[model samples]
Target: MKVQEIREIIKLVDQSNINEFVYENEGTKIKLKKTETVTVIQPTASPDVVQGNAAVEVKPAAPATPKAVEAAAPAAAVSERENLHKITSPMVGTFYQSPAPDSPAYVKAGDKVTADSIVCIVEAMKLFNEIEAEVSGEIVEVLIKEGQLVEYGQPLFLVKPE
Candidate 1:
């Protein structure tokens, strides 16, 4: 789904009483859950009582500043450029560093790897895709954190070519 559509869905969810919702189209699926609860009470008592209740839960909405969003865009672009030689995700999914919860990671930040080294796993559609390095190099940085949902074409690591 488009990002704008997702944003609208989120807004609707924030203002409603729904707890959870899921939508799937083609091969993509999105699930959203309300992380906090908001309660509104009817005023059956005096006006002073309603005013006191209103003062109980007066939290301001926090919105992202335009300048902060703009700054993040360039930082993301620069990181992509720096990891141009590293292999990126072939599809969108949750990235995992190990095969299982108890297993060791396929590679570490400083590990040297070849074109065929399995650097990580990207889980999509209940399948674990073993991501490999496309070039021989030492891993300079791991761009994604464990259990993070990544987008297609997003950089997963940085490799200094050997």
Candidate 2:
């Protein structure tokens, strides 16, 4: 079956309270099971099939370790903090660093920028938008490449406090 069909079936199974479901259609067969603590497991087949029978097993009791969860939590927190005060795109558009092809880039990494400095340009619906720096600081990073597509709220740079 198609991936979309499989995804739809999985979604349906997740919404219902069925504990186990098995279906056979022509040459394809699928089995799904849900426990009191819901966990979905993908099926696997062994190379050697004895007596033309395949054994299917589900292992769903595995829980994430505390260390793994703790590691992930810090990463999420760091990303959230880094993205603060981001100069996001006002509209979906292609971003540019220079006013024209032959001109120099408006701003570079480590450059001290202010609220009035035009940091980049965003071309949206055939109009070029002069994206300005909304805060004053030394640029720590540039998040987008020149001529890349930028969406609304996409970060353009990271600024270190001056």
Candidate 3:
């Protein structure tokens, strides 16, 4: 499904009372659920509250100027990382190194891969989705640990092209 269409569906669900919705087209499927939460603010109704308020007001204000942080030497790392290609997550999910927990990992650092290689699996909503390498290269780094929560578009691996 197109990104615009998915965004539109999300908009409709957000404005309505619907808590859960699912849409499927061809091989693509999307599911969304809204969570309701309650926030409670306590009212201060005692003399102690007023005393605490007074104490807070008596404290000096902080300086407006922000402290400058030391800049790291990033030229070499930046250029090297930029030259290497990346494989990123297609959706938000928990990353798995193998198809099954007991199985050996599909790929690792220094391993060579092709465009169609099944490098990893991402579990979203209890569904296991195999992720492809999409480019032929030698994997330079495995960016995520097994069972890590991966965000959409987050880099999963770095590759040095073959």
Candidate 4:
């Protein structure tokens, strides 16, 4: 399915009681399961999924299903997360942690970074786009791995401001 359709499915699933949704057609399979967060898992075999061709006929459980009520995060954890600086993707592309396959990653957890430091690369349309760290801090978390397809504005790293 197209990225937009997948996004829509994600929204629909998040707003409803559906914890898992699967769609299979034309040798393509799409599965979305809600974890601690809502994420869209890519179809494994679909070469090109057209919009309105997914043939998704979902009958979600009632909106007020007991399992749909997620537990809220603790106040301390939420406060800590709020204080961190997030390095987000500027565009949709594949995330690359290192310059080349054999090279070490630019930064990892506990690494200190400056505003101009090259943190990673995102390859889009055969062009490798070097992503920079816009804030100076110690890398507290690397939210994405190499070669993962990331969406625009998705958090890549969480930095503890220095």
Candidate 5:
């Protein structure tokens, strides 16, 4: 199965009342299960796995509840900050704020950046990938600290678009 298909499946399951869903095609198997706080997707075997094409675990920030619904009203204000663009890790890896440990960080909060500006590096399987801002903006926050393990598509920085 393709990654996009898997993503669609996840979206369907998340929105539905189903607790578990399993799919198999050829030699690949995909299993999705929803817990109180997380939705996990893993392969029964070694094919079409998400994380490095191996295994993947997706966690929701919080579970759905009445209290959470009430809290969401305040959270909606966060959308006011939606103008901030997120700089996300392209792959699962250790996030490095600098090219090297002794060097200064590529960018920090309040730093200005344009599309293609190298904001940080994600080291996966010994390969260092320089992450870019992809938007013209001022860095508003660094979501993750240096040398932290970041997952694919995880937000690393928030930028206030210029």
Candidate 6:
């Protein structure tokens, strides 16, 4: 299913009282579960009521000025990154930079990739999935390290699209 469809499903499940939901189509499977939280309130002794007609004055907080936020990096660098496309993981799994140990990485920074190019692998449930660079571009960055646990929709690489 599409990412938008998955987002919609998540929204529906979150808004409803359902605790768990699973969906599978073709070879793709998605499972979503909501964590339950329990809140406990303890009874406390009530404060003694004031028996005097004492006058009380309340002071309001002074108005504060908002500080100007400074940019962390140069504007050119930020603009360059904004033009890049991100290749993200399709499932929660371990990220592999290569098909196997001792093997050269599938792709790295400065490498050109097509939409069908296999850029990395994500192993989930013992199944090694070949992740493709869906956008034709020159890979500008590898966001995740090898053997790292990656979350679904997490960015793995940044590409300068052709």
Which has the greatest TM-score? 6
Clashing pairs in 1: none
In the order shown, the candidates' Cα RMSDs to the true structure are 12.3, 13.2, 13.4, 8.7, 9.0, 14.6
Off by over 4 Å in 6: 1-71
Error of 1 at 95 (Å): 0.2
Candidate 5: tens digits of C-alpha lDDT, residues 32-107: 6654443345535533336433544333234345544545456666665666788877555789999998999999
Q: What lDDT does each candidate get? A: 0.72, 0.69, 0.74, 0.77, 0.74, 0.76
Candidate 5 off by > 4 Å: 1-77
User: Which 10 residues in a row give candidate 5 its minimum summed lDDT?
Assistant: 52-61
Alpha-carbon TM-score of each model against the true structure: 0.52, 0.51, 0.57, 0.58, 0.58, 0.60
Q: Backbone clashes in each candidate structure, one number apiece?
A: 0, 0, 0, 0, 0, 0
Clashes of 5: 0
Candidate 3 lDDT, tens digit per residue, 4-74?
A: 56557767776875545555556666665554432324335322223421221112223333212222546
For residues 66-161, could you state the per-residue lDDT of candidate 2 as single tens digits? 544546558776665555567777655689999999999998887899888999999855677798898888887788998898754567887775
Residue 8 alpha-carbon offset, candidate 5, angstroms: 16
The per-residue C-alpha lDDT of model 2 at residue 108 equals 88
Order the candidate numbers by lDDT, best to worst.
Answer: 4, 6, 5, 3, 1, 2
lDDT (Cα, 0-100) at 109 in candidate 1 = 82
TM-score of 1: 0.52
